[model samples]
Target: MIDFFNNITNSLIFNNFFLVLSGLDNTILLLLISLPIGFILALLFALGRVSKIIILSKVIAGYIFIIRGTPLLVQIYLIYFGLGSVKFIRESFLWYALKEPFWCGVIALTINTVAYGAEIFRGGIQSIEKSQVESGLSLGFTKFLLLRKIILPIAIRKVLPSYGNELILMVKATSLVSLTTYMEMTGIARKIMAKTFAPIEAFIAAGILYLFLNFLMVQFVKYLEWKYNPHLRLNN
Candidate 1:
């Protein structure tokens, strides 16, 4: 049993473990780049969906439906390969960005997340009391001012818990970036296993890293929740 344990450790820590660390860094970078963009786009999409403008709402709904209906892997493949194969895309000014695996992964993740976050935000927005909007208007607030000062804050507070889950899920979803040849944790594990013929150890190490990151994320989210939820804070 001791020998087996030592073998597992050695396999996972082989070659100074720099490769695995690099892979972890890649995953972190992907999340950092994708999350803010996703959040912003989600807000816009959500507002669009709930807008009184019929065309705008329908367009946002269509975007939400298509993204939610398709698998993320397929979306990644389409962005990375399908559009990439086009002569126009390949030769266009945007080719520089499109050619990179990192950018492709970011774009795919951002779009996928925007769809989900939009729905969450929509729910939060809808939950707001109509009286709140009326009160804001009575105070001479414009639509934008009302949203900025009253609606968005309350909606964000309401949506934050679910959004936190979405954030953690985004961290895990970075694993799919491996398909685009990005060297995230899972990608590095795959390479290590192929070279060393030690799948179990390599995968176990990667899994542990993911779990650790996720735990940290959950704790951070909890802190934010505690800080923002006035009722919870006062009770505590």
Candidate 2:
């Protein structure tokens, strides 16, 4: 048993563990860039879905339906290859942004997260009490002020649990960056496996790293939830 453990620990898979750790920076970068972009886009899409304008709501709903229905891998491939195929896009000023694998993965993940988060946010918004809006108005708040000061805050709190799940999922999803040849955790693991021929060991190490990250994020979200729970007083 000791020999077996040593074999796993002393293998090339073990040495390459640092390489995997390095790739975490890339994974984190992707998450940081994508999360806020997803959040903003989600808010816009949610508002559009709830808009009084029929056409606006329909268009947003269609976007949500199409995006949610499609697989993320397909979406990534479409944006990376399909958009790159366009001569006009290739020649355009924006091509520089699309040229990088990092950006491609970011764009794909951001768009995918936005679609899902928007639906979550929409549900939270719809769940808000009509009395809250009326109360805001009674206090001489304009529509914009009411939404900003009252609706958005309450809706955000309601959506926090789901949004936290989405955030962790996004952290795992960054593994898909390997498909685009970005050297994230999974990408580095693939490289190590190729060199070491120890697929199981390498993958197990990578899985542990991901598990650690997700664990940290989960704890952070729990703390935030506790802090934000209005019914719970800190002094108590």
Candidate 3:
């Protein structure tokens, strides 16, 4: 027990604590960039999923299926390595962003999450009581107005817990970008391990950092759940 504590202290304090900490900036940036884009795109996809148009719905379903079925790492590889190899892409304006591991990671993450998020949002939207739609229609609300006024607000609250889980998953998923040499927390931890030959020490610190971040998010989500979900609270 004493040795474990001492080693962790050494790893964090005496080792490359600052360097590992520096990776937090990119980690935060990557999360901030990808999640919002993924979210907006996912909402659009979810709308497609729930659309009355058969072809549009099928196309969205196929996209979500392909993304959810494949590994995110493979998607990352295709974006960074496979797409990067294309002659047209290499010569085009898109290449400027595609060539950078950071942007590649962001694009891959956004694409990957959009599928899952769309499903989550679709579920939430579907969960709204059918009567709720009827109620809006009885009031002569237009489809677009009803959706904006009633559907979106309730669905967002309904999906809070599920979305919180997605948030945690994305936090961990960001670590995969380190493999592309983006030097996020996990990347920096790998470097420390390489230098000190202490995998446990480096990973333990990295794990702790991630754990704390996720923990805080979990608490925040729980608070939101408790706040927005008043009926559940009233039951208590």
Candidate 4:
């Protein structure tokens, strides 16, 4: 028990908490950069998938299919390693971004996330009752009015829970970038383990940090759910 407690303290306190700080910052950067862009692109793709334009729908569908069908690690490698291999790509200005593992990881994460997010959002859009849509039309609601008032509100509410889960998944998924030599939480943990030769303590510390971050996210989502649903607020 004493040894376990000592190891935990040493892990957190080493070099004035370098491991914790570096890992936390990099992870947050990845989340902030990727999730917002991913959300916007996902929403656009979702809207495209639902729209009547068959060609747009099919193109987005195919892109989503490829992303969803492949593993994220493969996508990361393709971005970081594969892209830089092409002679034209190597000579091009875009190589500046592609050659850096961090940006490559961001690109891969954003692309991978948008696929699942698109599907989640598409489901939300489809969740609106057909009769409600008809009623809106009967009421002479303009297409703009119908979307702004009915579709947008209900669809967003429906999408929140699933979207929150995706956020949590993204947090975990950031660990994969460690393989690209980007020093996020797992990468930091690996470094600590290498130095201390204590894999268990280092990994446990990283896991605990992940749990804490996810807990905050979960609570924030719960708060959003409570705010969105007045009925739940009333029950309290």
The TM-score leader among the candidates is 2
Tell me the RMSD of model 3 versus the true structure. Answer: 2.9
Each prediction's RMSD to truth: 2.6, 2.3, 2.9, 2.9
Clashing residue pairs in all predictions, respectively, total 0, 0, 0, 0
Encode model 1's per-residue lDDT on 149-225: one tens digit a residue. Answer: 99999999998999999999898889998999988889988998899887887887788789989999999889888
Alpha-carbon deviation at 73 in model 4, angstroms: 0.5
- Candidate numbers, best lDDT first, in rank order: 3, 1, 2, 4
Measured with C-alpha atoms, the lDDT of residue 122 in candidate 4 is: 96
Poorest stretch of ten by lDDT in candidate 4? 11-20
Q: Which digits, one per residue and each the tens of the lDDT, describe model 4 over residues 34-57?
A: 999999999888989999999999
Q: Which candidate would rank higher by lDDT, 2 or 4? A: 2
Give every collision pair in model 2.
none
Clashes of 1: 0
TM-score of 1: 0.92
Arrange candidates by TM-score, highest first: which order?
A: 2, 1, 3, 4
Candidate 1 RMSD to the correct structure: 2.6
Q: What TM-score goes with each of the models?
A: 0.92, 0.93, 0.91, 0.89
User: Cα lDDT of model 4 overall?
Assistant: 0.89
Q: State, as a TM-score between 0 and 1, how close model 4 is to the true structure.
A: 0.89
Task: Give candidate 3's TM-score.
Answer: 0.91
What's the CA error at residue 116 for candidate 3, in Å?
0.3
lDDT of 2 by residue, 1-236 (tens): 99999998777657777778888888889988998899999998999899899999999889889998998898888888889999999999979989898999999999999999999999999999999999999999998998899989889889889989998988888888789888899999998889888898788879889999999999988887887776766674
